[model samples]
Target: MALKVLSALDVAKIQLYHFKAIIVAGMGLFTDAYDLFCIPPIIKLIGRIYYDDKSAPTAVVSNLVAIALLGTVIGQLVFGRLGDQIGRRRVYGLSLSIMVLSSIACGFSICRTRNCVLVSLGFFRFLLGVGIGGDYPLSATIMSEFANKKTRGAFIAAVFSMQGFGILASSVVTMVVSTIFDATSDAPEGHTPDEADISWRLILMLGGVPAALTYYWRMMMPETARYTALVEQNVVQAAMDMKKVLDVPMSQIAEDSPLPSSPPPTYPLLSKRFFRRHGRDLFSCAASWFLVDIVFYSSNLFQSQIYHRFIKDHDPNKNGYQLAFRVARFQAILAICSTIPGYWVTVYFIDRIGRVRIQMIGFFFMAMVYFAIGIPYKFYWHNHINDGFLVLYGLTFFFSNFGPNTTTFIVPAELFPARFRSTCHGISGAVGKVGAIIGTVGFIWASKNQKKDEKPNPERMTVALVLLGVVCLVGLSVTYFFTRETMGRSLEDNENEDDD
Candidate 1:
């Protein structure tokens, strides 16, 4: 058979349309991050309002966090396949709509009984998770398809980096809301209808705005040329879309070469052929992502608990609002100082040094940082070394973003064929969320079981961090052995290699 010629899109020069695609797709990530991370502080506020307990029950909090993740798992699998069958643009907006509506419902969660409230909130958040989950595969695939191979890594990384901004936005919003409410209200201790309840509602609702703003643009986006040509076998339509996107005339080219009689058949994801070609790549992407999230979500979502333990004299007298503010402040500091910068570092270097090397370096350093923090846990805990612990903790966030976290998201989108890219990306993402669920729920159980004292026990936290370090090393190994480099290669080239 004659070698297939590269589509105009495959070798198109980078231009304005690429950046526009990045921003549109990246906004979904921004919304996803904001929606997911914003829940922690709100969970704390819920505890104060409903239970009159400063902290909610471990089981309840874990359910609240993990249920959404479960929704994401389902969404990723379902929507990813749908994206492949229907079209990327067709199903993209549905996820965001779910997010926008569900987020509003979550904010408005109210019932006479605490159980009813939990049930309602969980349901809506689950829906929100579905929306957020769909964004993962859709956005990554869109960015990857639209980007040129010369800067493909950077473009996709740029989309994923929006998560860092979303994290920062969550922290900043939580801090501002908490501070505003705390300042305005001088309610007596144990007051009902406290400011915290209102603040949580506001924060939750705010997550929906970005999603709403980007919905129209998402709808207006033309179907990706690769999907149209490679998947649907619509060379003419694909050529037309590329002409508009790349701003290059393709009429003459299409006239020169008539369209093929039929497109190639797409392989089933579960088929033997897929397993032989992409099984290792899928495992590498999923496993690395799983390891990264095991620590990433645990650390990010539960950082407040860790911070509370670190600070020796956390004043019991402070209202829930004040406490929430402090947590947000500390989280904001870490995000600004470490998390956001780490993402940008990956963006800058991913195209230069390549994905596998960056991922390996990230995992190796992450493992080392976790070891440094975990092994000396007692010293940091006993001596009340808050600043030192904070610095070390920040580094873990840094390397996590710079390493497996960003690379895992990028690789799955690039490695698989256009027909299966979204589905595979979703599968990898869902697997990662499984790890996130394990981490979130497991941390709650582990941390709760630790014997409470005036001084927190370092042993439980110490073990968790060390285990995460071990996971990172395992992730490093997976990346090294199973993954292939895709830098400076067309998407077609990468996919064609599997057929050979």
Candidate 2:
């Protein structure tokens, strides 16, 4: 079997295995989003149950949001490198296993004291983050490796699109749980602390269910042919796996056939040769992703608060289940109307429009939308133009998915060699998580400080929005200058694997 003829995979027709691969890989991301984004709608509920004044302390809330992100950084770096050194299939199940156990632990984090319970939940969530982090590189690299060149971007983006559904699922689950508790409670207000406690635990724990269900399928998947052939220098095994998965006659290599000469040796990850070839691409992918998460996670994690403070006035009377239900409903609505559609649109057009172009357009509009809202937030809020505000705000999310969010995940997988693909993707993703941590902590701190002053200041939020707008522009600049188009190209072509 000749390694150079690996184009059998690049030219393979769309088939059952490709879709199966997407489902198996995408489910991990689904769990990632559910666990990460679910916190915002329920954070206030946690405060009401755990604290005396029905408000979570600023530090506690910050840690709750950022700690898992810290774990995610560690997981991405560790598991990503392991995927390259060992194999993607070997570590994929381990990450999912960690996610399942940690999610259940977070749900069952009951302790005698508030401090004990908070610590338990925080630790478990950190573990959950590590698992979620591992999924980024493994899923993207796997999907890209399996896909035909013509639709590779769409396939990888489709895997990432699962995050949108995961986010939507989180909202829907929270809404359903809060509604059930509200209906069953004896009090007319139906906002009891006991109900709140039960509702949040159920929401966090159920995130594990999807990942648990997919574990068998994920493990059943074979190592990608690219990794098997190019990385391990085993063309025979690569061809056998390809024939079995794609069911293509040409892919069947004779067991007794002589192996072809190896491709050029892969450079060490930190070697000067590797850096000279891919350093800028790596920086471009990492920087663009870093900038995207700063805006994306900040807006996502605090949208409930943003809804109350900026889009609509907070109803002082509504607390506990009533407030949580409203927040969840809004989150669900936003997910359906903008977030989900944005992702699928990118999935549809990514391979056609190309990753760099869509990313530039996304970042450009995102910056414009941010400025539109931030510069005139007071005008819109005070004038009761909430609908108009919502429209502009929603565009940011729409562009985010349709633009850099999808591209960042896809580009890193394409821009590097098979041997280094997962490791590089993991590094880019981990840097993005660093941006998420900064965004999550910074936005929460600003929002919390405003609350401490006992006045909801729209101006402060406007400042945050303006800062995000600036960051988006910088992302746009990075994309324009550094990222390359990867449409209609084989993985080998993109990274010069043949020349190597």
Candidate 3:
């Protein structure tokens, strides 16, 4: 009987509520990406602002970039469990509130000493990260539950696809701000300019705006029908909620519909039965996310450095606003060329081609491209084939979005039971953040870039690329061996709602 209400959701015609849900859920991701990716281009600006002529230390750079990710790891675990225990809607707004306050706080961060200022910013970013982290499992689970099975992949992918725009927005926002500063505020050669300090703060504060706008709409959304019926065991309320969302006739869902003889048997996330049924899926999702993030985030957070190192177009003499503007422009172009398109393509084809195939294709091609670039890096470097190298490099971003980056988020939501759905997804996402933290922090050390003014090392870059390629192979292997196709399947069927 409870399954019947779920079936209505699985086959319900797409409507305004679905789109509303996407916007509300996806805006969180937009803010998340903005808050996160905006740091890359500004890391140098930050150093110049606070640390005088000396570039920020590698440790400082790592902390500034990776601290949010660490906070995300903690947020995912705590909020994920909370979503299941409390209603998704109940706690959803709280995450956004944290994001709103903390992002603003980041911009306003000030202290008497440089260390104190950086510390205050880090603390606020960590709080902001918690809000961003909570959005992951909650949004994915909410969208997956609300979507019809036929279009579920696209819907969830759409929610995630907003991240591409967020990344682009970060670059675009930074590019514009830096460009304005470049024109208006000129410091004498070798001195930090006042505009540089203002630019980064404005960019950080603006991330909260989109999130603040969507808070009301996010609160308006009801708890997912799956959660109401399956976890809370309230069939009438579940049916009532869906009746409004789907615009179904009340006759189909009686107000006094009798409860099931017994509520669906709940599986403890760590129990033997769950391990027997879903342990591999859990591992596959977690391991694949972990591997892909290490590659994905390392490149994402340090794209500025990577471009400056690999591309010869950068002027060594350029400093202050010119450097910031150039780096921001490069990142914007990269996002437009590769990152945005890759994400939209997944939204289009995910339901058509199925998740496993898309993931495998993405991983395989990424590995191939990494090897092609890494193995012959010196040849490209020496011959000044940076253009060709960039085209190859862009493919990694393209394939990443078209591959595991999107699917890893989608699969975990679909494969787990409603009772444990958000929790498991949070666990998977948290693990992915762990990989991201490693990638972001390890990248400087791995590239052997301890000093601020150091030139790129071909040997180190080659090793990093080769190692990332190996990680891709591992992700591919895990997907092929462990993940099952969830397309065209209802949530109930995917989670074996009938079995227990």
Candidate 4:
């Protein structure tokens, strides 16, 4: 029989079983996106409803928002360890059930009395966040393990790119729901609507359906054969699985003398020289992610501010009085349109160009964009000159969706080895969450600090972004210096490096 040497592209095509694994990995990202983009509007809705006055959200409101985030902090550690121990499929499945139940409970909380509703929402949101946090580790691991070396970045990016889809979806959904709530009157109805009108329960209910249906979404995926082969010491079983995925006959499979049945790695990641060598790069990754939170999240949380500010300032319709619903709807539509395309870009090119170049380019330019905004802002606020802040803000959004903001999610998965994949992801995610916490809480502080001068406070935003730019520049350097180009590398390839 003649030997058939499949091209690299041919090597990339796994069986249906492996394709399904990518879907399962992506589902977790969808949940993560749902939690992320939806929360901003939902929190805004709470403000319009509960804290109609100029008051900070109560402890209940604050706690409710933080629950998922805090849950994520814990979930990363918990599921990360579990994924390594049990297998990605099991941990991933377990999380779906937990999330579905929690999301369902969140809907029912609409019946709660007064502040108690916040309590219920908080608890369940925390649970949802946990599942999402778990999703991050497992999804990235499975995708990385299964994808071909040449296109691993694109595959992981494509799978994770659903996050942008999820964000865009949330934006569109919130807009539609807001329109439904506002159909009765312009401007957020000062008074609560009838049971049907203000039914947050409907929104909550809709989000839960996916959680319930997630199992069907991930129906066909098997374990990562590479994980089993490389980490499990079950060479025969792993080989069998790999043969099925690659559509190769058993006789054709490589049998470079079987690896010894082995106990797992012994060195603590922090204690090992190999990891310690990479420590600064990892820290840079974590810190850059943290900085992304400060700007990226804060901008997203305040998306409504742009529209609301626009309508009130330039619109002839001070007479028409646009609904809060209308503002969000338009904004959501625009954001979704902008984000989805960029995600697909990741799907197509992450492997070809390399992750470091993407990160450096995105961060470098966004820094420039932020500086552009700062100059106009300095003129507009510091000089009492409003140089169309809203227009510049739109530009900021353009760059935000297109650049570093999205790449941050893709890089960590590529950079780390499987042994420390989750821990590294957790550390990066936790760093990002710290930024999110600030985006949520710190925004209030920034808003409060701004006096009625219509003056842009130089300290809060301008200086903050400047500092963020410095950090981003530092991240760019670290990426260039320490990070390797991870394009076209597979789990098997990286794993084999230890022996070499």
Candidate 5:
């Protein structure tokens, strides 16, 4: 039998709806980054307000960070499968609603005792994490399915790049809010109880606004033609929906036809056929993401500690507002200098240079940077050469978004069959979150053991940095051996499914 011709969606001209889809999906990612990274500074404020300590307990902070990641893992698995089983558009709005409600709950978290407050906050964050997790598979799959093959990589990269913006916004918002409160308060030394309480609540609650704004558009999105035809066996409806999105005439698709009457070969996710076809690819995606995230989440979340180490005469006596402002300022600088640009670079070149090549370059550069910083830690520290350290550190962030961070998300969404696309992406995302949990918890433990009066412990930080370099090298190897380049190829061509 001859292969069926391309459908309207596969060959559709790039149009305004493509950009709109990117924004609707991209905003969810923006919310994810803001909600996740914003917590670090607020956690510091929570400590000052509730416990009267400069930082929260190591165990408490670790839990606060890891619990949301845990929720994300579960949410990804559940929502990813549901997307395939039901439909992408049907389940898309549900996650945003979860985020809106949870963010509000987190902001309003209150209790009579410190422990109760912490517990309530963690609970809400976990729920928020679940919502954030759902966005991963849904947005990635939706964007990929909607995009034209010629520019799919760039479109997806554009969606992922919103994360950098989200991170930037978190820092900017924190700085602005803290500045306003500090200027108004009459308290000379530190944040008053009321000031600290109100500030943290406002920061958290603001995360919900973006997610809520995107909800109407998310509901209006039609199910992907690929999902409708392949999974639901509704080729006519799929054609109509694709016509709406692509703005092509129905006559253009009249010659195109449904898939074969004979069913495609079925393989359970854990079965041998599945492994033979996709096992290595899945392992490659999951493992590379796991490795990158260990450094990515830990380094980004613990920037406060890194900034404090950089500045000499770092007063142990600074007030809460002072500490929060400085951290936000430094982070904002890093985001502007390297983080945001890295994401856009990938968007510009992903289709031209290909995903695997870009990822390889990113990992190789990241490994080199980590080694440079780790081996010279003592020299950099003792000589107070923080400017040098900061440049190298910022380079790592640059390459990370430009490299494995973006590729990991893109590969899983593209490589798998539609039946399993969302599930596989979810699984890949969940694995990455597991690495995030380990990294966050491990860093807290490592940092806590260092003596208070000593200069930042170069020896201990050296070990962590070197380990990150090794992990990047491992990720590079996996990308070389297992992952395939997906640029300029239709989803049907990549999967080789019969279109009848």
Candidate 6:
């Protein structure tokens, strides 16, 4: 007889004890988003405070933004290798420690030169990126291994989706800091702020605390049962350990016996077969991430793109602080409010629906979003048409979180056998960062003032959208035609197929 949803639900649902696992996974993503989002506001403050010669050059600041990403590229590549070679939990623990150390350094630094600070911050950020980079594959893979098959998509998506919270909080934290500083009456004598008291330094400090707390909670977490099963080849032990972690009965676990452990003293990703099966997914994962980064990060870092437009058009006389607050609040609310429903629906249905369908739908919508953005530009070049453009942009962002991105992230973690899961996912994640690096480097290049107009050309924006549309089109094809649905499948199935 076929398994009922109720039976599957019992098999998949987490026990109260396992709630810690979800929190730990979500924390990693939260810190990643928080760290990335914090940079832009800090950049604005630095530009306002130090540069005597007008605004901070976009090229210089963009490099600072991209620098950590560069480090992330390296970290993802290296850690992906390590995660596959070592246990996922060990690597996961290491990443949290690295971030805490690096983040503290970022908070304490007292550099005066913008370049010096950039270099310093870049170094610390790179380390932070490394930690966060490692977390992507490690946490995502771990979450997939730990979660039950029926609700796997939701668990992983919920964890990944917390990134929206981090992004949302970054803006809110800045606003609150700005408000507090603005509240002070007398400049507090000799304690002048770089950009009106709540300088970029303050922003860096806020990004640090979340990761520091991560180490505290992650200790309470246990190793994934899949990892244990692979390492020890002890199915009963694996089930019992899983039972302890998830608070379930051995019979409740609904998968085949664990695959044989790879050659002793090393993890499976180090093996050749590990790469052969998952290599394409790795490259595609990285590239899609990178492509997505190009568009999103550009807009994120330079709120000047959208906020500046609003100021230039409607509120010519609007104060910078007031304008910044309004922009931050709107963006934060938009991100936070839309995420849970968007992600939860996918989680609710991932098992019933195929992974490929969800991914294709997201990619198709992603392509359309960019294509639609391009169409608007033909009608109003650099001219703000209506609220519709903003609405479309937000919906596109919604599409990103809805399924494809969330599923794209979860796929490698699930599809690859236990041995290669981390390494393969890591490499895939790195490819995404590479794409992000290109996007980051390219976005500023694309935005370069080719003319004296400096009107923040919407023409170029259209061009960028076109490129994303192309990537989305390719991603849609790759996911639809080449990818297999991993949902409800057992990890042992992958290894057996590998042997065949």
What's the CA error at residue 2 for candidate 1, in Å? 9.0
How many clashes show up per model?
0, 0, 0, 4, 0, 5
Residues 1-500, candidate 4: write the lDDT tens digits. 10111122226565675556656667677767765656545654554455432212433334565678788767777887787767777677777777777767777775535577677778788888887777777777777776666766777777777776666666666667766556655443344333432445555556656556658655445666655654665656765666655666666454546555566566666766655545765776677677666666566323434533543322333211123344445456555555566566556656767676776776676677667655455445344323354555554555554555666666676676666666677777777777777765655444333444232244565665555556557666766775666665544334434533
In model 6, how many backbone clashes occur?
5
CA-RMSD of model 1? 2.4
Candidate 4, after superposition: displacement of residue 468 in Å? 3.3
Q: TM-score of model 3 relative to the true fold?
A: 0.94
Query: Which should have the higher lDDT, number 2 or number 5?
Result: 2
Per-model RMSD to reference: 2.4, 2.5, 2.4, 4.6, 2.5, 4.5
Model 1 lDDT tens row, 1-500:
22122355556678998888888898878977887777666766777778775566666767888999999999899999899989999999998899889888988988746888899889998998898899899999998988877888999999999998888888889989887887788687544245566788889899888778888989989898788877887777776776666766655326466755855656677799888888888888888888888888777423644655642114556666766666667667777999889999999999999999999999999999888877787566445556777787789989988988999999999998888899999999999999999988766745654465223346777787788889889988998898899888778864563466
* lDDT (Cα atoms) of all candidates against the true structure: 0.80, 0.82, 0.82, 0.60, 0.81, 0.65
lDDT per residue as tens, model 6, 1-500: 12221133336656765466777777778888877776655554555456532345667657766777877777777776777667776677788777767767776555677677767777888888888888888888877777677677667877887787787888898788766665662443323344452344666677767766767667666666666656545555556556556545556654454444454334245357545666665655555555555555544422445655653412433333444456567667667665545676676767778777887787788789778877566456346645776776676676766756677778878777776778778777777777677777766765666774244556666677677777778878777656777777765566554244
Alpha carbon deviation, residue 4, candidate 4 (Å): 14
| Superior candidate under TM-score, 3 versus 6 | 3
TM-score of 4: 0.83
Q: Ten consecutive residues with minimal summed lDDT in candidate 2?
A: 448-457
Candidate 6 Cα misplacement greater than 4 A, ranges: 1-12, 185-198, 234-240, 249-276, 279-291, 298-303, 311-324, 337-341, 378-381, 452-454
Better of 3 and 5 by lDDT: 3
